[model samples]
Target: MALTKLVQLENFRKRSGSETSVAKVLSYSYASPLLSSPLLSSPQVFNCTQLDDLLEVYYLSPLYALEFCLGFPGNLLVVIGYVVCLQEWRSINIYLFNLAVSDLLFLCTLPRLSWLYANGQKETSPYACIIRRIISYFLHVNLYSSILFMVWVSVDRFLLIRHPTRNHFLLRPKVAMAVAGLSWLAINIQVAPLIVLMFQDMQKAINSSRCTDFASLSGDTNSFGYSMGLTLTGYVLPFLGLCLSSYNIARLLKVQDAALQRRTTSYKRPLRVVTAAAAMFLVLYSPYHVMRNVRIASRQEWSGMELCTRMYIEGLYILTRPIAFLHSVINPVFYFLMGDQFRELLFAKFRQLLRKTGRQRGAT
Candidate 1:
């Protein structure tokens, strides 16, 4: 009887080990069902089965660092230049100020995310999960809020040019401030659900061995309807509004130029503004949104795509993600280049610095 009991205990241990090994294998195999053939199915063989190569770590970490370096100071300058130096606040400046604030908020998250990528996301505390979720939420908030503010800026420009005297109430600085506040509130509310979803996912992954690995697990839906909804509402509609506003502004400028051919040069600045806004939407944001939708679609179980196709989609996502962040860096540059007052103030400040330096040299 003693021998039989010992044999039973040994058999139980073997079964438990096998089950744990299979569970581990299944976790990876589920990421790409097509690669789950019996020949390469064992957990030992697929121990390093990640959805994509670790190459993204090398690619994304430096890009995040670069973005932080450029975006932080550039955005801060915009905020300071508008708030302190410019005494007369135009309606458009209000939108620009809020946009700068949104960009700065997003920039604040980059160092943490960069460190995670640089060292590998090995911080597995529950607090790490909460922090990651907050970062993700604000990232989206800043993105959508920036886009909406740009839309407001374009429309304000249109109103200023197209019906300068008729819509005084619409172009008031107070109205712009109200719109900016509403945009911030709306975007935060929109992204609040994602925070809850991420927390729930973290609960399920509480026992995950590696914190970095746990954080990598996305709670994003693979549903077609959800992807389409995001694309249409978040991207397509705003893009359409921007285009319409830009087109009308261009048309009005052309009409004005034709009416007063000698005043053609006056229209150039406004035209440049429209062109810059359109180019920003086309170059920086469009690809990111399209690639994001494509990546989501590729993850669907019914897609029937091979592993290579999925890999490509994942790579494209990693590549475009940083490109989207470039918008924050570019925005301040755009404001300085396009705003006459901003440029004037920047030059004045530069001359003041030069004078101050010369005085110190004379004293020395």
Candidate 2:
């Protein structure tokens, strides 16, 4: 919001003609109208508001920097660990591996924003706008495809338990690749229009140009439709599918023996994994999307927020960025905790403990 205040102040300056120096500096980008009122000519657009400028210098930049520095490295490490530590050739693991790669593409753009803001929003360019859009496209695709793959994994488990004889085809390697491909294609179809609507030739409102959901900006009708679509496609359906599968799996386990139930629950760690992934999704993404949709519905600018609203939005930064990074990081932890092969590989210490316990019981 502070950064937005600075831009608005710049806009007011560009409205009155007194601030020739500021206009001259921003003119190099060829997007002087971004801050200036469109009706005012460049020479006429000079004026400044004191309170707005003071807040910009004091608040937004430092807070944004602190958030980014903590999230970036952890996001990168998630992808690296998955590739090196995970064995290849399984379909589910491959999709997760690629998901991490997509998130890292997003992680890479933060420093670009950090630099742009640290320089007082002067270094922003049209190319940065395009980069932001491209990164967003990939990130959205990852969001959809990752959830779709998880649903597929869940249903496959559901079938494997309920009808183990006939539909075992769901577990094949080739079929998983086909599922992955179909997931990517479907998400691409959903998000391709965002590329057309990206509005990347200019920068606006400070550093958020580094990442954005431009689909939410296409006037009220399109904005409402886009949010609904995102809410349904990215959120509602995924959560529903996960809950349904978990419900069925839990029900099916209820009639089994105690020993079998323990073993089954141990192997069902993927349920917990998916649940954590969804929680992180809600944590990081919900606030950003909700605020964006609210902005669209109200048809107001970002700067008009009251002090409390602004602080709440700013405060979400602590949860939002880290959870986004955690979305990338926790998948590897999921694999380490849940993957059957990795479990076998790492359970050697547990094996020793079990053996010692068995010997002690026999001696007694």
Candidate 3:
């Protein structure tokens, strides 16, 4: 009986004339003794390769390119403006400077990311893979560091309002510098595990291209859990800090207005600015964090979910990536609006340059 079964399997393999067909035959032949069915047809594999190709080519490519173009010049001007126009560094200035620097670092990755997306293939070369890993590392580092610094900025504003005359330690430049350093260290430590996961992904895809977004990496079963933990620590905590700081500042401002018998509109500007910052924070980050988890969840096998539904979730996740980074462009505007002195100083410097050029032209 075993010999007959083996002969029948070999004969079927010979007649099918394709490697895939023969593999299917072998997969079923060893399972049962009787060949009751005519032949085991190849099972359909659920693949989203074409969907990924289209998303990379259309969505991420243009969006990342736009971010690089808009973010680079704005962040560069912030760094330059800080160095040139500001002679005295305060705690707020320290945080703002570091925030600009973090944005610049993240912006540096956008061009390479844009190229990778436009090409619509994962990187195969070791050098390219290493670069992609570095990009991922710095990307999260910038993200968390930026959030921490912004939280500090909100706290600084709160402190200035709450204790206008007192020199609180948190309001000191040296202490702010220490906080900034620790923030960078903490963010790096938090993001280090992602590098290991990416490395494992790289190893698994040695024969094929790899280096996808973290939500899409197929390295470890714990990736989804890790992502959830990261979102809570990196985003949720800082968001709460910002909200608390902003709320206290608004309350203090309102109290001061009542004490002085001033019009409600007298403090309206600061109140509005603080409220807007918090609102912007929620709008930009909440969707990204939510959709990212959904994307990761969609990759898992579910009882009754369709592949098309998973594709739609991934597409929404892709849309949030660039939108979350739009803060880089909005941040410079905040610099000018929030710091009246800095804006005046920057404008004065530009006018001085213009005057010098005009005088030189006249001399010639």
lDDT of 1: 0.68
TM-score of 1: 0.80
RMSD of each: 7.3, 10.5, 8.1
lDDT of each: 0.68, 0.52, 0.75
The 10 consecutive residues of candidate 2 with the worst lDDT sum are 43-52
Model 1: per-residue Cα lDDT at residue 337: 57
lDDT of 2: 0.52
- Model 2 residue runs over 4 Å out of place are 1-88, 120-124, 159-167, 200-221, 257-265, 300-325, 343-364
lDDT of 3 by residue, 20-58 (tens): 343454555444443334342111111332455577789
Ranking by TM-score: 3, 1, 2
Off by over 4 Å in 3: 1-49, 263-268, 301-305
lDDT measured at residue 321 in model 2 versus the true structure, 0 to 100: 34
What tens-digit string does per-residue lDDT give for candidate 2 at 283-350? 75576566545544432342344322433443333234334434544444554553436445435545
